[model samples]
Target: MYKNINIFTDGSCISNPGPGGYAAILQYYQYEKIFSQGFFYTTNNRMELMAAIIALESLKENCNIIITTDSKYLKEGITKWIINWQHSKWLCSNKKPVKNIDLWKRLNITLTNHNIHWIWVKGHTGHIYNEKCDKLARYAATNPTYNDIGYI
Candidate 1:
């Protein structure tokens, strides 16, 4: 039987490509786990992808998961654009290389281990989990601890 998990994630960047952070809250019934990490340099989009990727990667076994995020880039990319991008050898419609390919690949591999549903919520909209994640992410971005190797 698959364990059911709900995840809330958010990412923040001090500037477009400056200090960044990602946060994820995982809830399994009455138990919850929070994860957050800061990177010295990264884009907001990369941080967003990292939030979801880290959350999914934390699971120890195949399970049913619902991932909620405030990033349309992440939600639409995974749910709507990934297949085509993969089929096209990771090229975007404009024939440019896809950005954040490393994180995207990580997310794809992690995804194969479970059944997942992606959800998108507007940021700063008073959604409880979303707001908490946003606060965590913002705090992390301002207090970065590591460099984002992929962004360097």
Candidate 2:
């Protein structure tokens, strides 16, 4: 038997280099789980990348994971561009530095063990799981008490 799953992820930052949060929701069969966290200082892109990395890391092994995200940068990086980026030592088209190289590296390592299908979705379009993740991430970034409530 195989377990097919869909995961939605997003991240929020109050300001660039400010408070940040990341969230991911995983759905498998009849079970679902939400993971979220807050950081004292970060950026939205970082959170977006982190959510994807965290979700992939949570997978046990060899699972089919369809990762839905709103960030085009993330979807493109993980699904289309990471291979070339890795080959080029993480340089951009202009041969300039790649932003968030650390997170990209982490995401690459975490994703190596799973079969992940990256999907891009429009943000704030009322997708249930995606909305949930966004809400969690925003709340985490704003509310100190709620920071990193469920994510380990």
Candidate 3:
């Protein structure tokens, strides 16, 4: 039987394209693992996608996962738009290349290994794990330690 995992994620940016960070909390039964990282230059959406991607990639084996996030962009893009994007060779409705395609591609690849269900929560709405992820992401954003290679 596959282990069931729950992941909560959030991201923050000091500015639209400034210091940013992403955080993910992975829970299995009563055990929890938290991961967060700051980047010197990035966008909030990128950070949001990174949080989910990193969390999925961290799993050691195939498992059933339910990912919770506050970003509609992340949830919608992955669940609703990615199929169209892939069919159009990564172009959006405007015929423009998709933003953060690098991260999107990475996320798509990571997703192939597991069964995932996505849940969306409103930000800062007092949800326990969401609140914790927000605080962790905000703290990491203020103390960036690495470069966002895709952004800079």
Candidate closest to the true structure, highest lDDT: 3
Computed on alpha carbons, the lDDT of every model, listed in order, comes to 0.92, 0.82, 0.94
Can you write out model 1's per-residue Cα lDDT over 25-136, one digit (the tens) per residue? 9999999999999989888998899999899988999999999999999999999899999999999999998888888899999998699998899999899999999999
Worst 10 residues of 2 by lDDT: 143-152
Pairs of colliding residues, candidate 3: none
What lDDT does candidate 1 reach at residue 55?
91
TM-score of each: 0.97, 0.88, 0.97
Candidate 2 lDDT over residue span 97-134, tens digit each: 67888888888888765677888889999988788999
Weakest lDDT window of 10 consecutive positions for candidate 1: 143-152
Once fitted onto the true fold, the runs of candidate 3 whose alpha carbons sit more than 4 angstroms away are none
RMSD values for the candidates in order, in angstroms, are 0.9, 3.9, 0.9
Residue-by-residue lDDT tens digits, candidate 3, 1-152: 78999999999999788999999999999999999999888999998999999999999999999999999999999999999999999999999999999999999999886899999999998999999999999998999999644743
lDDT of 1: 0.92
Off by over 4 Å in 2: 144-152
| lDDT score, candidate 1, position 106 | 91
